[model samples]
Each structure stands twice: as structure tokens, then as C-alpha cells.
Target: MRYRTQAVAYPYWVVALLLYGLQMVFGLLAIVKYLGPDPIRAVLPFDVSKAIHTNLLIVWVLTGFMGAAYWLVPEESRTELYSPRLAYWQLGLFTAAGVTAVVGYLFRWTAGNKLLEQPYPVKLAIVVVMLMFLYNVGMTIWRARRLTTTEGVLVAGLAGAAVLYLPALLEFDNYTVSIFYRWWTVHLWVEGVWEMIQGGLLAYLLIRLSGADREVMEKWLYVIVGLTFISGILGTAHHYFWIGVPAYWLPIGGIFSALEPLAFLAMAVYAYAATRRSGLAHPNRMAVHWTIGSVIYSAFGAGILGLAHTWPSVNRWTHGTMITAMHGHMAFFGAYVMIVLAVVTYAAPILFGRPHEEHETAIGLWAFWLQIAGMFGMTMAFATAGISQTYLERIIGLGYLETQQKIQVHFLMLLATGILFAAGVALYIYDFFFLVPRGHREPTPWPAAEPVEA
Candidate 1:
């Protein structure tokens, strides 16, 4: 809020939260299909609903990331944004493309390649949007002639994400080849570059919320980014195992996949050390809760649960089961979702002219805890369902359909927990849009600005 252009982030957040709410709706619909006979199966089929559910997650999270960057980069660079106009255009184009792709999927107009189901044109539009985003952000930094390591890592991650997505645009006739490259986008994203994005945001949040020394925090951030590349790049081989890849990938995947948790562990330690050194004295207690929660939850969900099934032997049994879903739900929530929420919570007071010292609200607190409890419950539900599935279907050789019937109870748990999670999301959306005041406060310099080396 120190800069006038920072206001551009508000609209982006508004769009992101709206999409988040819509995503929960489709997610509920998708789960309902699993628990009972489909009433609207013909009109809104499970495949379509599931695709929309997954795609919305990616879109809304990306939207949140972009908005966070718009808010953070200006402050980090000690200047206003390079072009707020360009940023708004980018958001409009990206949102339009996302909506078009989702609508197209409803009519069965898709590439039908799992998460990369967006058609060719939609993909191109996405690439262009990314270009615009990077250009605007890059120009902002260049003009300021100052860049912090925290924002540097973040911008690098966003650039890498755009580059990695190029592989998805290529057309491969071989099914195995297509699947191989698909992970380049999907796995490398959530597991690789996306982690860098999470780390950048984490460092920024810790520095702002915990009053952590910027010098020490950025130094350790270097280590976390190193671990991410060391493990994440090679960990792509893990996905290659089940595919028609060489036998060498099994060991390579297992070893590197096992090492992947190191990055998440480092993040957890990073947060802990910061909090330990600088006690939680920040007025934005809600953002602190979210920031700390993101690191701890990610360490468990992304690191521990992921390591559980990612090994070659363990994965051979639980590769495609609800176990992956289990790991995915919590990991995505803790790593990406929570971090974004932390930024939003931290910035809301500044953006809306509310007093920073008294920004924490009862509604916000409930939203945070509800999401934590709900995601934990949902993860357990998926874990139980996955374990049951692995035993009955994979081990006992039960037919898929029969195993599904036996696991209906677990699906019930999933639905019930999913509703809890959805309610939390609803509350968050309401808190952001309705509860937070709309009056604008005059711009003021950040009182706690720290010296930067990088």
C-alpha cells in the first residue's frame, strides 16, 4: 500500500477468490458423483467436473501468485510497479482464457490429456499471458535497478514455470512420449518450480511477519532453492517409473524422490528459526498463523506423505490409488494455497486502509482453522481410502468396480470432509470480499524496511 499502483493487486485477488469459490462447487459436484448414482451425469459428467475442479485449482492459485507478486515486487524493489496497465491486461487475458477453456471442456472440446486438457488456442493464450506478466515484472525491477534475493527467486520460478510449460505445447504421437512430457508440466510444476514460488513467498512472509533478519533469511533461502533443484529436477524420473521408461529410472527416481523432502524440511526449519529469533510480535497475527501453518503442513503433506508412496516399491502398489490424491490435497493446500492466503491476509489491511495492528478478525481466524482442520480430515479420509484400495484391489486382486463398492464408506468420508473444506473456502471468500472494509487509506512508507544485499 506504500505505492499507489499496488491497488492493481486488489482486483486480481478478487478474481482469484471468486474462482476459488467456484472451484469448490465443482469439487463438491465431482465428489458427489463418486458417492451416488449421477442425477445430472449426462449434462455435468464426472470427467468434466473433475477436469474443471483440477483446472480451477491451477488457475486460481496462479492468479493469487501473480497478485502477490504485484504486491510484493514494488515494495521489494523500492519503487512503484513498471506498468499497472499491463498487469491488468494480463489478468483480463488470463482470466478469459481460463474461463474459455473451462467452458469448452463442458462441451467435450478438449485435448483430453488429463490436466493439460486445454485446447491449442487456449494454451497459446496462456503462454502469451505469462509473457506479458514476466515482461511487466521484469521491467519493474529493471527500472528500479534493485532486486532482493527473495523476489529474484520468485521471478525465476515464474519464468521457469512459463518455460517448462512449453513442453506441453508439443504434440507427440507416442502415448508414452506424451505422458513423459506431461510430467514436465504437471509434476515439475507442483513439485519443482512451484516449490520455488512457495519458498519465495515464504521467505517474504517470514521477513515481514516475524521481523526476521533479511540477510540470514535470504542466505538460507539459497539453500532451500538448491535443495529444490537437486531433488526436484531428478525427481521427475519418479513419474517416469510407471511409464514405459528405462529401468534405470526406478532407482534414480527413488533416491531423488526420497531426497525431495529435504527442501520442505528446510522451509519448516527456516520458518521455525525465524520465529524463534524474532518472536511473533507482528500485529497481523492471522497472517502469521497462515505463514507458519503453510510451512508445517507442507513439511508433513508434501514431504512425509509424498515420500511414503513415491518410493519405487511403495509406489508400485499405491501409484494410482487415492494415496496420490491424499498427498496431493494436503500438499497443494499447505504449499500453494496457504502461502497465498498468508500473503492475502498480510496485505489485506494495507490494501483496504485497515489498521495493521488490529487487522485480525474473528472471521479470518475461523477461516484459517477451519481450512486446517478440514484439509487434515480430508487427507485422512483419502489416506484411509487409499490404503483400503491398495490392499483390496492392488494386493488382493479385487476388481476395480468391486473395490470401489467396498470403499463407498470412504467416499462418504471424502464428501463430508470436502464439505467442511468448502465451507472454510466460502468463509475465506466472504472475509476477503465482504468483511474486509473497502475504505482506502493514504499511502505511507513501510516503517520496517530492511537493507538489501541482493
Candidate 2:
């Protein structure tokens, strides 16, 4: 590690990896519950397992994000962390809250707000942790007397995410009203500010990994951000289609949400363009694979799949069906999960003091393909199940349980794919933790690379 303080990220990333592995466990469990007799139905219900699965994903992704910032900011700012001490405290608070939330779910203690299930105290703690993290991050940049657009965009996104969460802190009794504001928090984060974070990090990784001109890359970053804001903000209306909202939102949502894919397309183009310009001179080309993989997969998942069901007519049929799950699985995995893993792969050498030559290995390649194939199969499984369910239940007017019974075959397929995906996830953790690290040395001071001229 360059900075002694960079070691702080070790615990952060470690916790993230562990939680990520546990996430797959719950995910597989939920899928199994769908496929067969519920041996543990009385104790561990599907809803609880699903909730834990989803919540763990959020916590771990955010943890990975925070950890990435800790590792990247110092090198970017040309200074050590403002307060490693604060980073430690923030991770502790974040981890504790995650653990408590998981434990509480087992006991059925929740706010029951559908995905915003973290209890009030835990929510408050999350806010505090964000505050600490942002303060440390902000102060670090401030102290360095330097800030790149890449870093600026990243910090802004993180700040925006923290602000958006405020709405989740409040409660509403009316279902319509609650759902309205709930989108403000969830949809806005996923479709809005979080894209900026992804764009920023994507820019950072591509520039460093591809040997591309920083100016051209950041210029594309600006375009991506502009497109994101243009589309994603109004894309929020897509959720308003059947939510007792005004008729105007139907057209507005369809128009803007469809455009949201444009930004994702631009991101994929941005990564590919940068890499082609440089001819992949970077030794850790596998990291480049991940970086570029995130871009294209996100376009396919979030952009293409999202467009598939985003229109009002299409959503009317597919909204609450397996189609939603299909799109969600690909979108989240493609956009958020892959980007985080991209950074983890790219930064492994720097973070762990390994030689750059050891960046990507054969095992890493295996893990990557297994995951990509597994997730694709899972998406197809969901797509088939959803289509059958929609046709049986909605179109043919069959009862929900009866339709589900008819679709049990798809559930079995889902379990099979889930197991495959889970294995890939396991192999990833194993390769990242066990095989990636073999020795350690005194912390070496890594000097910032010379600036790439405009």
C-alpha cells in the first residue's frame, strides 16, 4: 500500500467481499425456496431471505464504493487521507448497522417499507456514517489543494446520494404518498446520482488503465453526465405510471426513460473508444476487460433491458412480473456490481502491494467468465418465468398461486442458474482473497503519476 492509511480500505474491502459472498448465500436460499417445499418456511420466510439478500447487496456495494474512494482519493489528491481514523470509525458504524439489520430481519423486526426495511436507528446510523465518510473525503481533497473533474464528479455524486436518502428517513401513512416519495429516494439514487458516481469511477479507471488522454476521457465523462441528468431525472416518472399519478407522466416517463439508455450507451462507447485509442498498453488488461465489461454490460442490461419494459404499454404488462426481476438482475449486476468489481480488480495490486505483473491471472479469467455466463443464464431464466407468469396470470386471468404452480418448472431452472451464479461468486471471492495475496512487505510510498497533459 502506498499510504499507510490506505490499509484502512483493507478492512472495508474485506468486509465487502465477505458480505458479497453471504449475499449469494441468501440469494441462492431464496431461489431454492421458490423451487420447492419450504422446509424452513416457518422460521425463514422468502420475504425475509429476499430482504436480507437485497439489503446486503446495497450495503456491500456502498461499502465497496466507500472503500474505493478511500483508496483512490489519496492517490488522486496527491496526499494521504485527511483522517484514516475517521474512515475506520465510518466502516465500523456501517458494518455494525448492516449486521444488526440482517439480524433484525431474522426476527421480523423492520420498518416494512419495502426495500427501505432498515430500522429507524439503523437508517440514522447510515446517515451518520455517510457524513463521516464525506467529511473525510471532502477534507482530503480540500487539503490537497487539487481536484480533478473526475474526483469532483465522484464527490458530488456521493453527496447527492447522501442528500437523497433524507426522504427515506420520513414516514407516510398513505400508501400512494409513501410510494411517491419512496421513488425519490430509491429511483433517484439508482437512476440519477448513482450514475454520476459510476461515470466518474469509470472515467478514472479507463484513463489509468487504457493510457488514454485524460482530457478526451473527461470530456466524454461530461457528455455522459449531461445525458444522465437529462434523462434520469425525468425517468423517475416511469415508476409513476400506475401509482395514481397524473396522466401526463405516462408520456413524460416513456420519453425520458427511454432516453436514459442513451447515457449508458455513451458510457460503453466511452470505454471502448478509450481502450482502442491506447491499444490496451496497460499490463493488467484483465482489469481493462472488467472496466469495458461494465460499460457494455450496463448498456445491455440497464439500457437495453430497461428500454424493453420502460414504456407505459410494455410496463403495464410487465411491471410487477418476473420481467422486472430479469431486468433488475442484469441492470444491477451489470452497472453497479461490475464497476465495483472492476475497481477491486484494478486496484488489487496497489491496495495489496502486489507487483503489477500479477494483475490478471488464469483463475481470474475463469471467475469472470463463470460469473458472466451464470448471470446471463439467470436473466434468461427470469425472462422465461416472467413471460409465462404474465401470460398465465394477467392475460389468461388465472389465479396467482395457480399460475405460479404452472410455472414451477421455471423456478427449478432459476434454482439451477442461481447455483451456478453462486459458484462463480464463490470462486471470485476465493481467487480475490486467497490466490491474489501471497506475501507482504513494508508499506511503500507510491508517488502520484505525472499528470496527463491536455
Candidate 3:
């Protein structure tokens, strides 16, 4: 923690981690609902459970992203946060909004949009929170006048996410129009601006953890951003394919979506090249592991798996199936979730005032590998179930319920793997809150490394 104001990020991380644990709980409940005899169907139905599960995921990951930015921006700008009080207020209000939205969902108070299910008031609250956040961050950069490309890209991504969310606030009378614009928020987010966020965080991690050249890493950031816009922005057409859009979108979406992998591939190459070129190891090996793991997993999950289904021909069958879940689980984890964890793990020692060498705790390693194994198993389960569903229902002409019944075995696999994933999440939460020191025991200034030119 170079600046005293950086301490503000601690509470943000705490909230994010707690919400992450809660998300896993809801996810497990969702899987059980899929596999079961309906013991609590009247009280906690599958739709509500699934909605809570997905909403919690988005909330926690965004919380993590904000926390990471709060941590990163000050360091990059070489100044204290412009307003710690404002940051805390933003966290509190944002959290309240999220919690209120979740509670409301239990009672079925929602707008019924898939990801944008939050009611109008909650959406307004979220917009207000984002405004507060951007104002504080933007002011900090202006005061310091030292915005690095890394933080610049990060802030831009965050701003774009806020702007893009405005479309979700609008309601359309036409279902096709509603669905079309909904993708403007959903697809553009995870695939577009969120990729920029991932790239920014990835560049920061690679440079710091590997002692990689700032110039080289920043250059890679440009390439990643360029690739993301070139592929991701246009890739929005892919979701429009079956949404009663014009037929021209079919070829346009396929071509651009296919090119989407180039961004993730560039990130993978960026991390690898940074590590190899620097050849200087940071003591925080677990952070390095996560940093590297993010790019590799995303390449396969977000890039490869996404491409596998985004084609008009394939997605015509796979959309809204378990296959989407398959890609979503791994892609979100790899691209957004892992990068956030990378920053958390990297900052843990400084935040807790522990020696940097202490970062590779036994519990941390277990948490990392368990999550990897669990998510891998979950993806496999979803893939098999989706394939079977597509064939049994889409091709073999079975009813949806009949198809699901046939795929019960895969649901069993999902439950088992989901439990493992939940366990990993539990370990991570425990390590963060219990094992880590509540406050600094001793003065521990992390030694700054000289940048190694690549």
C-alpha cells in the first residue's frame, strides 16, 4: 500500500469476497434444483435461484473490478485517492443497491430482464453509484496528471461499461427490439468493454509481477484493446442472428466473432512473453500463477469455446442451451474473475502487512487448484449435457422436459463439480478473512523493482 488511501480498497475487497461466497451458495442451490425432487420448489424455485445465482456473480465480479481499480489507480497515478470518503460511500450505496435487488428478487420484484433484472429504482441506484466512482477516480487522475496507459485503459473500460448500461434501462414494446438492445448491454459488456478491463489488469499484473518492461506491456495493451474493439464490438451481431434481425448479420457476426479469439490469444502471448523476457521472478508466485492462468484459460474458454458456438450455424442450435452455460462459466471465471483474484493475491501481502514471500500460503495454493479442477469438471459436465440436449430436443424432436430428464445424469455431474467449486470458493473466503491479518502487525514497505526492458 504505497498510499494511505489505498486502504479504502480493503473493505471493497471484503464485500466482494463475501458476495462471491454467497454466489457459490446460490449456484449450488441452482444445481440442486436442476437435479432434484423439488423439496423447496414452492419457496425457492429454480428460476429465482438461477436468477439470484447469476446476479450475485455479476455483482461480486464488478465489486472485485472496482476494488482492483481502486487499488491499481492510485499506484499508477502515484498519488493518494482523490477522496477516500467518496469511495467508501460509493461502496456502501452500491452494496445496498445490490443487496436490495437480491432481496427484492426473492419476492419477485424485478423487471424480468435476464441480467438487467433489477427494478428501475435499483438500476438508478447503480447508475448513481457508478457516477460517484468515476468522478472520484477521474478526479484523482486529474489531480495527479500521471495517467499511465494501463490505468487509462482501465478507467476507459469502466466508463464505457457505465455508459453501455444505460441501454438496459430502456424498455421496448417489441420483444425483438428489446432483445436486440439487451445484447447491447450484455454482449458488449462481457465481450467488449470488459475485455478492455481484463487487458488493463493483465498488463498491470504482468509488468509488476514479472518485472516486465512497462513500454512493452503498454504496447501489448494497445494491441489487446485494438483486437477487442475490432472483433468484440462487431461480434455483437452474433447475438442478433436469431433475434429476428436482418439476415446480413449472419455472415457479419460469424466473421467478426471468429476474429474475437485474437484478443485473448494476444493476452496469452503478452503474459508469456512478458514473463520470459523479464526472467526475474516475483516472490508472489501465486499471483503469477493466477495472472498467467487467466490468459490461458480465457484463450480456451472465452476465445475457443465462444467461437465454437458463436457461428450462426452452431449458435442456431446452441443458444440458450447448457452450452451457453458451459462457455459462460469458464469464460467469466478466466477473464474477469481470475484477473480480479490476481490483483487481490498480489496485494494481499501489502494490504495485510505480511512479507511478500508469505503470499504463497498453502491455503491459497489449495484454493487456486481446487477452483481450476472444479470449473474444469463443471465445463465438461455442461458441454456433455448441452450436446445431448441439442441432439435429443433440437434434432431428435423431444420435448424440453423429456430432454432434461434424459440429461439428469449430467446434472448429477454438475452437482458434484459445483460442490467442488463451492468448496474452493469457501477456502478462498476463509483465507482472505480469517488467515490474513486484519491489520498491519509491522511496517512492511514492498520493495519496488526496477523495470526490466524486454
| lDDT values, one for every candidate | 0.91, 0.87, 0.89
Residue pairs in candidate 1 whose N, alpha carbon or C atoms collide under 3 angstroms = none
Which ranges of candidate 2 are over 4 A from the true structure?
Answer: 444-454
Give the per-residue lDDT of model 2 (tens digit) for 1-454.
5466767777888899899999998999998888768899999999999999999999998998888888778877878999998999899999999999999999999988877999999999999999999999999999999988888888888889999999999877888888999999899898888898899899998888877888888878999999998999999999999989899999999999999999999998888788788767777666877788888889999999999999998888887999999989999999998898888888777766666667677778877887888888889999999999889998899999998899898888888878777887888788788876765555445524412332
Return the TM-score for each candidate structure: 0.97, 0.97, 0.98
TM-score, model 2 to reference: 0.97
* Tens-digit per-residue lDDT, 315-354, candidate 3: 8888889998999999999999899998999888888778
Clashing pairs in 2: none
In candidate 3, which residue pairs clash? Answer: none
- In candidate 1, what are the lDDT values of residues 19-44, reduced to their tens digit? 99999999899889998799999899
Ranking by TM-score: 3, 1, 2
Q: By lDDT, is 2 or 3 better? A: 3
lDDT of residue 247 for candidate 1 = 93
